[model samples]
Target chain A: MPALRKGRCLSPILLALMLVAGLIALPPGGRLTANEPQARLHNVDIREFAFMPAELTIRLGDAIVWTNRDFAPHTATSAEGDWDTSEIAYGQSSRQTPTQLGVFDYICVFHPTMKARLIVTR
Target chain B: MTPIKTTLLAGFAVFALTLPAFAQAGLDDLEVAHAAYTADVIDIEYAKLALSKTKNPEIKKFAELMIRDHTAVNEGAAALLKKLGVQAKDNDFSKALLKGFEAKKKELSALDGAAFDRAYAANELAYHQTVNKIVGETWIPTVKNGELKAFLSQALVTFKAHENHAGHMVTAAK
Candidate 1:
């Protein structure tokens, strides 16, 4: 009887974890916030058909933030990469910390021509 | 479950879990959208890089469109994330994909004139089609949020048109 009860309880817990895991598996960025250590104090502004600072630099532990100030919506995304906030919208911001040190480039999803670069370093 | 319960459950699941909850959370659906979201952004960057090196007018035009459309979607998504309170992501998969795209872009950019145009268009067509399939099969069914569902749906429509146009450009170039 104890064993049966234990099994029942355990399954729901496991089931719950699995569900959480599923959502976590979604791409980065769509679920990002303005505050994340990955891109510490990094700012991205969307205006005039371009993302300002087409080139930005931040600490490895820091983040790069994008705020869509343009009349049109714009996303700051990595072409072949993933991000905490793969995209950002007007009057909104997203952040992420680059785990590694290198130059990362991203573009606005709506307007691919609007590209920007993030240089993450120690 | 009753509609009210279902809606409640779905809402709770989003706060407690993630996208396209297959059984309850539809994690796969969210992943598909996330993946496409990631891929779209990556493509946008690639398009920019391609435009800089390529001389073709049509290709340049397409790159510009990617910037505009992707920005809207990303921003819309960011707004939702804010409401959800879930943290933004910078996972290994996204990092690696960007690296690969950069390498490929470098290789493709090495070509010039018509060859460059042909390669760029070919890549765009392939990328868009794959994204369409992933979103259609994995994302649409999994997503439970009413607003997010609608957003993805509209994005897909725009994406399909973009793919069609890219295909036309590639074929015309050839």
Candidate 2:
């Protein structure tokens, strides 16, 4: 009976070692699992005195990032006084995640001529 | 010629020659307005050159802002002049400013790439600073017309912002 119990324990240990070995033998590029949650992201490049895409459309719950590629500082200020990213410096980024669905117009207070629109859809 | 007649003729010639200089010396409200307008034009010109020559996105953006804002200011000045029944007069100071800008443009045109961007940014910073100082200290105080003074005062706000922006660019370039 003692020998039988020892055999049972050794069999489980061997099985566990085989499973770990199998995992190690798998290809480097192979994915172990899936079903991870990832947030949707959009990028707006502020370049050449204007936003590359002056208008951006996204779905609700999605996030948009503005990257300033200019030498000077800029701001994304809402026309209606709703939201504002005070100042985005050179090579820096600012993000906005809008919950509401509508068309929003924004401009740089420093350069009022620099305007852009963001549209969010449900 | 008689001595008295010769002296009178010399006096007349002196007065005739010096009149233009005297007119330019103390810029009246009209002349000051014209000079301000001309300064905007000069800034726009330099910005256009920068836009054409620079590949750096930051510098290009700055140049574009300069062009757009200065053009708007110029247009506003034009409309105001038209409404006020005033003609923008060319004066010695404005002429000298343009000449200096021409030299600066030549210097900038000779540079390329990063060198061009740094030089352009530095020049912009200096230009805005000088303009801000002139508008705030000299032009604003000396302007005689209420409307013109109000315009200059408003313009000074814009220029101060530009000066701050340019200062940032200069620092970033370094």
- Top-DockQ structure, candidate number: 1
User: Candidate 2 — what's its lDDT?
Assistant: 0.73
lDDT of 1 at B52: 81
**Distance (Å) between predicted and true CA of A91, model 2?**
33
**How much of the true contact map at the interface does candidate 2 reproduce, as a fraction?**
0.00
| Candidate 2 residue B111 C-alpha distance from true site, Å | 0.4
Q: Which stretches of candidate 2 lie over 4 Å from their true place?
A: A1-122, B1-24
Report the C-alpha displacement of residue B69, candidate 2, in angstroms.
0.5
Tens-digit lDDT track for model 1 on A15-101?
567546652221243332222233336677766556787888777666566776653555777776576365455567776657777
Output the lDDT of residue B118, model 2: 76
Local lDDT at B87 for model 2 = 95
Each model's DockQ score: 0.10, 0.02
Tens-digit lDDT track of model 1 for B1-174: 445334433443342232223213334434444655686787788778777877787788887777776766676666766676654455444454455566556657677887777777776776677666656766676677766676677667667767877888888877
